[model samples]
Target: MPSEGEPHILAEIAERHARIGREQLALLRAIGRLDPEAPWVREGARDLPHLLAMRLGVSEWKARRWVAAARRLPELPGVAEALASGALSLDKVVELTRFATPRDEAGLIRWARHVSVWAIRRRGDLLERAPVREDRRAQRDRRAEWWFLQEERRFGLLAHLPAAEGAALAAAIERWAERVPAVPDEDGELPDLAARRADALVAMAQASLAAEDRADRPTVVVHTRLEPSGGPTPGAELERGPVLHPETARRLSCDARVQVVLEDGHGNALRVSPVRRFPPEWMLRQLRYRDRGCVFPGCGTTAFTVAHHLRHWSRGGPTELDNLALLCSFHHRLVHEDGWRLRRDGDVFAWLRPDGRPYRPGPPPPAPAGPPRPAPADRPRPALAAAAQARCAPGPAP
Candidate 1:
């Protein structure tokens, strides 16, 4: 019933698909063999997953799966063989590695070939270990701590919860996060789910404070020198918190209820001024209308954004519409606290990174070609015996 060349064409297609599988296996093995201290660190990648994401043009989630599969391939010869032979796919192998032991990999390969990738993943989920029975030790281990990093001017929360309570808390945060409007990330993509959860937690805290009826909400008192005889007063100090960078102080002062206090070198207040908002209201409304959302490329968040002064008002910068730019909280922090710099050139704004390079999204250009590399083998073997020998190598008897 088939045409004469149809079978040949189909056979060639099959051959190439199998060849691709073998190539993927070889790539995974090489990734596995990479030294922990690879050159990716120097390029600003935090770890292997980040490096893979940047260099290979893949998502961090996908890179993590590749790294995980590569690490286990050295122990699963049968699984590697099936992948190389195209009996199983890269997705199937990645899922299998989640729970497949070397001894059981042969059986899994047989089962995987007859089923869909989803089926294999479902089976992997089922095979993963479940929570242990809660006991006194588990209850005693539960803890939550709030810590601050002075140098980074960052705060962190760490918690260890019992499985039941942790699940409940996670579900609550997830539900609340759904109510929080989604925002675009640095790359202009929808924000990471983890970030939404963090925002949800902050929203919960804000809601708790809003319930209390008072003459005025609690205020954060920042001690700053109005007169900068030097280049700039080093920074402002929070009443009970760590010292804030000058840029951070300027950002807070932009739309805040600011009460300026002229203090002497002896720490006595010389004059106290009435509290007032910077830029007033009409100018802020016009600035918001002109910029709508964050002016940072790709970030279009309209909520929780502030008007940033192109030049600090403290240094004789004008409080005019031309001197303002709308920025989201994250990007504002980047411009102020982080070493990123932003300036307007005519109607266009230029963003510069810590190293003074133009800030641009997307991965860097690929490195130049080097010497031709060796091709991968069709059938690779695990060095089980060699590993065992090295672990039990003979030494002087103790």
Candidate 2:
């Protein structure tokens, strides 16, 4: 019960398949045993099959096979046929035989059809110029160091410890090593030398602290971005002091999108706005208490923190108190681009890991408990001493 049109369509498809097969076989045979590097071969065979197929609007794979077959032929009849049919060019077809194997030649031709001839030639040149035995030891060393740094990054507290402290610890270990006695048994066995050295240095530092008089510490710079909400109408004038840090001023000049509250000469609030767009100062104060610090899990960064809307502001998310969370640059990126999930319930915040597991944000484990305290001295001793003193001399209350 097939329609009459179906038979005609099937016949046309069969004829096309047959024509492509014949062309492929002819093209493959014609370009046999050509030098790959020769200008004619490079130009003609580089991507002839692919280019020819594209020109004919045929499949790249089909074009490759046709070019490969034409390359193997003693005469260029197949190549000529393809050129006549506008399937290939005489310049491109000549290089097809340069491939060591028919499979490689076919693949090259197919790729050529999809890609430009210039690209194929460039790739060939690059491949020819690539180093075979270059020294990679330095690269390997760098990779190892990179991996070590990545591991170190996971321990945030340790990562942030001053480099000077690390150097001092190393020096202490070296000094301790000089004082320790060497033993034949120690040759193959590792000792608890590092821990012993650390304990000795810690005790020495603590003793020094007890003897030295403490002095007033230097004031720390407060670098924070503020976002105020509510109160006065937008566009109120606020006085800001001169920029103390040139780098901070420069950064603000380039990308001053942080929200801040402006204060007048008398310390009265003026307005709130993104460092660029001025809003009322009272509004900025409203957001300060809600976002105490960066809301990102394990991030203590206060500077460069932004008030991010959990739901986008453009999508009808409110610019009010409840919808905003303070996030540093790194955490903001994680929430926006990286696949970290965040949820807030009442006052508590939860972070979900990449594997859909909840992250436990808690303090680090406490050090192991010390030995039990000694028993208290008996009260009878003090009482006996008091009695002796009373017997020696009766005294009135002072």
Q: What local distance difference test score does each model get?
A: 0.70, 0.43
Residue by residue across 349-397, what tens digits does model 1's lDDT show? 8888778998655544333255223354444422321222223222210
Q: How large is the C-alpha RMSD of every model relative to the true structure?
A: 14.0, 32.2
Best by lDDT: 1
Query: Which residues of candidate 2, in runs, are more than 4 Å off?
Result: 1-281, 367-398
lDDT of 2 by residue, 1-398 (tens): 99989999998765543343333333344334433335321111224543343233343344544444454544444334443343543234433333324335545655555665455445654564334332242232121011123655631111122335546766865776655554334476645665455455556667679999776332222132223443322232213544334223322322223444555445454655433421123544565456655665444345556666655443466555566666665566555544566677788677776567776644333332542223343322222222222222112101
Poorest lDDT segment (10 consecutive residues) of candidate 1: 389-398
lDDT score of residue 198 within candidate 2: 48
Clash count for candidate 1 is 0
